[model samples]
Target: MSTFKAPKGTFDLIPPYSATYLAVRDAISGPLRRSGYGYVETPGFEDVNLFARGVGESTDIVTKEMYTLTTKGGSELALRPEGTASVLRAALEASLHKQGNLPVKLWYSGSYYRYERPQKGRYRHFSQVGAEAIGAEDPALDAELIILADQAYRSLGLRNFRILLNSLGDKECRPVYREVLQGFLRGLDLDEETRRRIEINPLRVLDDKRAEVQKQLVGAPSLADHLCDACKAYHSEVRALLTAAGVAFEDDEKLVRGLDYYTRTTFEFVHDGLGSQSAVGGGGRYDGLSEMIGGPALPSVGWALGVDRTVLALEAEGIELDIPPATSVFAVPLGEEARRVLFGLVTELRKAGVATDFGYGAKSLKSHMKNAHRSGARYALVAGERDLAEGLVQLKDMETGEQEPIALDRVVEELRAKSA
Candidate 1:
């Protein structure tokens, strides 16, 4: 049979590139761990109603891209297109809110499925590093989340990213603004789908990427102007805190997020290097989402940063990720007797917390050394018959090409000391 290919819109993270994925995960999660955001995981698919309600019925995720299926028992489920809805569902089910902690801080790294036409940086399946803070409405919390995300991107030595901030107007005034927005959009000559959006969520039409949609949106009533006194005050507080924290942001008057549940504060991280698809990551506050999903009124805010997009951003900026070297040592055996001894010693070295590998299936010395270089081993141990008889091994520094003999019994200790 011909070799099977991966499903359309999805690709495998094979070998050398897999290391880069791991590095990005570690680098991003480090700050969250230190900041006291505990790790949480949820099922890839949950009840279909979860996203329909939590993510919103009018959004593209539930309306267009969700992969839904029915179990044998007849319950409907869907592969999660985003993490926040699932996380919030779990938190509500577990009653994490009632645990007396004001804001339940969570950090997650996992795959999300979206059934759409895949393009560069956008995929049917992708991994994300996301953070959520539930049960809090403090502007400081909003600023904290933005600052930490900024810190993570900078820590990776990534430049050419801009943080855009906006407020979607709180409940006290957003409904009033939505009416004005809807009225204005209804007058524009647009597609039936967009006009339908004006009836459902007038704000979402602003997020449309189509040039045709953009051209007609010029005179639409902006949410920023429609904000009531209370909504305006809350937005000012968030911006002030962000500014005080030294995080610069562009005030985007038309930055309506894709999701419908967001209220109060919203923001996005965009990279200039990645053409057309400039958004590397973004998050916003969803004050009413908990109530929307049949839970109590719990306010929350979070962001999901795209790992694949971030890597693309790095490549666009002509930046190289400083990945760690693979194996530290490669063991080369001259003969059967030497192989037997070297295998045991290899195990001992590993037990001492060293990354060591052996040349398998009795390859020639030249081929074994070439394999060592290919594996990115820094040092190679040559255990020949003579060295085995003498209870010693020759250590050759791969890069330096310098060799030295050490007693076999002290192999682990010697390697550890030298690597240290």
Candidate 2:
């Protein structure tokens, strides 16, 4: 047996199964396009400091999950662990932020890398369908992005996901709450890693998943309790917009995203069945990130939904994606002459927007028929020397096992009529 395998924490999306993945990506990106979000692609690797500084030095993504390498040129580069920072950097480098637009709305779908423990819904290498609106920080913009994500999920018939919302307050209030939260956490029984989180960004400490730690810190100060007047008003407006749009969300006071630049709001998307990796994806307001990244003072909000986690959610709910068939018609040539002629005809059919496939080898009629049955084709066209001499071919309905003679030149037209 061959010994080579896909890299750990990565799997191949082979044919048929790959169809579902592509469908999900297209479905998610479709709404974003209609919503005035353009597509953008960024470098897979960037200066290591881009992530360490933008993603936050305190977060696990920078401190532990980053895949960094030292180049011969003496520069340190890292495979991007997330999309937001790369997108922001790309926008700034290209001056897209200065296009006289309030917000540069864009969407991206691609692979991201992280060095971490591989588990269900979590991979060292994974895929994300992320959206970002740079340049403006209106509560309405945040609500629009959230609603777009919601629309994408619902369009896929997903109903079991939860949108967890919270306001981490702004610079004015978050620091005050951070100090109070850290003081309270310092006195609690916690692990060294989490205790350090309390020091770097105490709000992230509230995100701990340990039961004991959770229970001990249930009394910890909530961001809601410390929201400044302006922040409180902004949070209220976002909640109101979501509610008015019929998007349900649970107020999660502990949903402090582990990023130093995130402010005013934070959120996550969770599926109950995912256990410890319950978060399918999430994003929220980061009004100060642009300034931190050496860009203009732009306020923005965005989210990255794990495509792998999304597929898992569909599986957990026992919902099957209706991936379309690979080909609509299969051509069976009975002889060498027929094979040569039908080969060209199939190409013509495909050129006319028909999905067509043809048997490659010279096999028994019954064998090809059986193969056609197993090929997932709606109709099979059989052309033999005798039928070709008569300017006709046999049309077989693989589903009903019915067959008939049609003019060889009319096969494409007949298939179109049947499909329509």
Candidate 3:
């Protein structure tokens, strides 16, 4: 083996497992594709200020987890820690909002970078499938995204995951709740850093996972209770729409996502199977994010499902996707003349949409057959100089051990028919 290794917290997705990875990503993106969410991509890194301004400088994602770099030109850049802010930046830069198509829907699948202690279902570099609907504030849009994600997970045969829902009241009333929460936090026995967070962003204190901090927050004021009439009506409409669509969710009063821009409706998808990392994916309505990032005032909502976490959830439930093998036909040539003939036939079969593979160089028939079997091929094609002289090839069923001779010209049609 090479002396070098993959970076400390990254991994290489080789074959067999890579197939499942792609399947997981596709399973999540498929429903969004059918729902009119066009695909979009952005640079892996962006100006550091973009995230600091959009994701909140006080949040852990921006302050502690972001991978920042100072370029030779002295420009501060950072590897994206999440998908939403980058997508919104791309949408605004392209002026998609000015086109008059309200709520420009888009989907994206890619790798994200962050600095954190790696654990089960959590990694420094991870993959996610995300969707965004920009420039609309309707409750139906929010419900549609939640339902679409639910349908995607169900399509993959997953049943044990739960949706945790909450509403982080908008600008009109969130400040009032923040002050009340801060007053309560200050009276509790807490660390200086915890107190500092209450000053910069009191909502983050509710998301703390520390047992001591949580115990002190048992009777803390709730944003759900402090929402103004407008915010409360908006939250009620979102809940009603989700109920009408048959999606089940639990009301989580403390579900303030790690981001600062979320407003009104917020949610997270959790699977009890995952130990500490229970959240497989979640997103909320970030109505103020555009103005925070220096874009037009656009109300938007979206969600991103974690491909890695979803795969882990599938393993925990022991669900296997019925994915087909990469190769259906394996070709083995016995002699020099047979090699030329079989190679040509292999090329023809592949061009005709057949999944095929072949053994290279002269080898014993037994070795070639072993390779064919290990490849998970459905059928094996064998040809020798003698068989070629008669314009025939021996086709053997890998599963049944049945063998028969077919004319050279008929092999392609025979295999195509069987594959179909």
Q: lDDT of each model, Cα atoms only?
A: 0.90, 0.87, 0.94
For candidate 2, give the lDDT: 0.87
Using TM-score as the yardstick, the better of models 2 and 3 is: 3
Q: What are the per-residue Cα lDDT tens digits for candidate 1 across 1-420?
A: 769998999999999998888888887888888997999999999999999988889999889999999999999999999999999999999999999978999999999999989899889999999999999888888888998998899888897899998889988788898888888888888988888888898889889899988998887777888888887888898889888888889999888888888998999999998888899889999999999999999989999999999989888888788886778989999999998998998898898888899999868999999989988988999988888788899999998999999998888898998766
Candidate 3: clashing pairs of residues: none
lDDT of 2 by residue, 1-420 (tens): 779998898788888778778878987887899999999999899999888889999988899989999999999999999999999888889898777876999899899998888987888999999999998878999899889999998898899999999988888887888788788989998888887777787777777677888899867777788889999999999999999999999998888776677887788999997778888889988888878878888888998998988888888888898886787889999998899888988998888888888888879988887878777999998999999999988888888989999987787788877865
RMSD of 3: 1.1
Total clashing pairs for each candidate = 0, 0, 0
lDDT leader:
3
Could you tell me which 10 consecutive residues in candidate 1 have the lowest summed lDDT?
317-326
lDDT of 2 at 304: 92
Better of 1 and 2 by TM-score: 1
Whole-model lDDT for model 3 versus the true structure?
0.94
272-326 per-residue lDDT for model 3 (tens digits):
9999999999999999999999998999999999999999999989999988999
Question: Ten-residue segment with the worst summed lDDT in candidate 2?
Answer: 201-210
Error of 1 at 104 (Å): 0.6
Residue pairs with backbone overlap in model 2: none
